[model samples]
Target: MYWSLITGMALAGAVTALPRLDSRQGNGQVKYAGVNIAGFDFGCATNGNCNITAAYPPLQSLGGPDGAGQMQHFARDDGMNMLGGTLDQTNTGKYDQLVQACLATGAYCVIDIHNYARWDNQIIGQGGPSNEQFVSLWTQLASKYASQQKIVFGIMNEPHDVPDINKWADTVQAVVTAIRGVAKSQMILIPGNDWTSAQQFPTKSGPALLKVKNPDGSTDGLIFDVHKYLDSDNSGTHTECVTDNISSAFSPLADWLRANKRQAINSETGGGNTASCQKYLCQQIQFLNQNSDVYLGYIGWSAGAFDPRTYELSEVPSRNGNSWTDSSLVKACLARKAS
Candidate 1:
């Protein structure tokens, strides 16, 4: 469900009124087919500014039978998560551009901080920012977007290599508190340590992530963020998808979340454009669809400024100037909805 923007209204400290959109609405959760906006995930090596507009049209078209919907906009990994630095103007402008594009298109935008597992090659708990520094960064972000409800905050892309599992959970709780202290009502997506994969949930920090609490004394607004891939190792790196791994690995995660009465979203999952991948994607979505009470959504790996079709995660998107041509990837995302 998408929401239109509100205009022609000015009340003292009143938020612009748009129809509230909720992706997790009971068992009838809207199946959102969204893409990840890339470029900024490359960290400091690439240009800091993002051409978010160039990626929106293609994402808008991926909305299934429904109209234009949500897409996760990745921010530059500029060591802010590690160093707890002030918000840089260039990246702020890019985030604004992304929000503006989504606002214009009557779509929801997810602000994804693109730091994966480490900062500058150092893992999170081992030698990077202390719990307080990480909390401070999230606090700044929460304050910056305190008023926007359509915007969802993904705490950290994928935290890994924490010396102590409890420390990771404690750090996440602190960040959640820091955000809530700013009085921001935005939904928060919480990922487990160690790449936050479904495969890691039973054995790794995923269990610890359940201990996170909001300042409201509840876990009401938090969503579990997970990723899955069809490759043999269940990592997104390879193109060869094992035939039964989808059921083998993800089914247990579904069972666990359902048992706990918690909600989750596979915010990242993709495979190659091969015929087998098509089958894999459809089967994966079908599994999530059947378990809709616990699984809120599934988003493809990516497409953006620097992301090319060569990246299997991009679903082999072919660029025509600034625009992109569709592939079988979009069809796979649309399959379960049509069923």
Candidate 2:
């Protein structure tokens, strides 16, 4: 039933371009809008195509003892897994490499700090270092890349299974404060709790806005990072998922941003690219081009992943020969001009 709805919506908006927001007419505040593509999660790094096998094959299969052995091989070959490495925010070398790659492609790079510290992997918010750890990480990241016009700092990925919104807000505040200390001008992307749901932003109880005292005492560059997926519970989606959501699905977050006087961007959205999905994905590009105000920018789910079923774009296939590139997806993402 839902699929039919999505199909209808997709067909209805096929002829017309997505809506647009007049950014230039505003208060000279150029919104930092772009895609949120993850290249590294802890220690796993994806090459430009976002495939794990292209860069590190051992960690590709997270199996049992063999998986452990493969992980060791991966660590030896590709440095260390991000979870085990020193949480040194100042280490910008790896980040610099990722940023350079994205910029070279003429796309915005969104770095993800996939932190989870709890008994169940389900506890997305349970585990992770203290507030100080995030502070250090952001301080280093912001200080190093703060000046770059294209770089946007996504504080954290998804926070799930965590009940306390206040605590999450506090943690986000600490990181925001720390990042502000160094990257005053750079835009800070903040996502809501429970995996950054559009519905949660309005109903969730937390510090609604992250306030920072700039030297000039004016609110400068702060952005709301929102991740949306049409799948069940909004877990995540690929290009097709975004396409289906464009017609009737885009209104919730769009309305929120308008009411809050805030700018919103999909820091992450992409999983399993198929033919229909590819067309759906291209529709999002058209959507972004038309709607510049509510939809600031976006980032694809990954630059690398073990499962080919979940990839939106990749340089090589995890299962076998070189699939190399999804020309359709790439073409769609790069087609729109930064408005």
Candidate 3:
């Protein structure tokens, strides 16, 4: 009976595999696991194809009244307290709500852990917690949402200040193993080092598949994650620069995947919501659409950030005023269907 139930589910899941958006055949439409994917970020909190940006829920400040330093850096009592409370409160109901919201918006909910204590220093050459801590966190998160179908897990936001590829591979394996234990079907995204830069994807000598030993001494289910930023040097605002950078970095990885028969996804990209970077963002979407095989999908850098002072996306202040959502870049991304 147990085997029969498992078999039934496997068959059902197979039947609903993510669909491909084929532009050559008809109007651009997105298919996910054999079905059309409604593409929108749940975090955006916008309804339908609306143009208004909604404010993020008021999260208690990790930093004191001033909001001076990085909230994820200090690990202060208040911050940790808030973190625990938010996770406890949201992980269950909030996750479900977010997932439903995205589905309603015609998109899948790509849940990002966002911060892993390593990001603070990596942006400036500072180091973060030991790899063990990261593994433990992954294990816990994987276990929490092991059974959800709509959730795609992004392992880490950006791995910066970490140059050791071997260490990165090991960490990836650990997290994948831990998550697979509970949620075998949930797509796991493994980013390359240095903010998921395509430039850093293992070209000549790096672990191809992150593997871990199962109880029967076998391994399965891993997906490579790559992020493409048009300007690696972080200079210039030209759309061509973005497209060129994406073409240069992504072409190699795309080729590698085809040659090796591996799956990969462009999990995240998009700079701040500024007029200067709008064209760059659209060009990126167009490029990804052109090469969906190499670039499976994308999740923009953010719908919103906890820290309004530094990571603000909408033009209006998150605390006081309403923000506009229908930016040119975001519209391009949402309107983009698999092509």
lDDT by residue for model 3 (295-318), tens: 555444322223334433321112
* Per-candidate local distance difference test: 0.53, 0.43, 0.40
Candidate 2 runs further than 4 Å off: 1-39, 42-92, 103-107, 116-128, 205-207, 210-218, 237-243, 246-249, 304-325, 332-334, 337-339
How many pairs of residues in model 3 come into backbone collision?
Answer: 13
Give a tens-digit lDDT track for model 2, residues 1-339.
000000000000010122244433233212332222222342321111122232221122322112222222222322211111113343344334444544444333444454421222333233445677657766776776777655556665555556666667666777777777776656555766666654566556223544433345444556676665644445553333434466544555555556655566665554445566456655654565455666655544433323445443431112213222233443344222311
Cα deviation at 90, candidate 1, in Å, is 2.9
1-339: candidate 1 lDDT, tens digit per residue: 000011000000111221233333235432344555443343231112223332222223332111111221111110000000025676465445545554444334566665553455555555765677777777877787787665666776655555677877777788888888875566677878666777787568667878888776777768788877788776676765665345566788867775665677777777766677778787777777666666666666654432353565553345444343445755555322221
lDDT score for candidate 2 against the true structure? 0.43
Stretches of candidate 1 off by over 4 Å are 1-31, 44-86, 307-309, 316-324, 334-339
Report the number of the highest-TM-score candidate: 1
Greater-lDDT candidate between 2 and 3: 2
Q: Lowest lDDT 10-mer window, candidate 2?
A: 4-13
Clashes of each: 0, 18, 13
- Report RMSD for candidate 2: 11.2
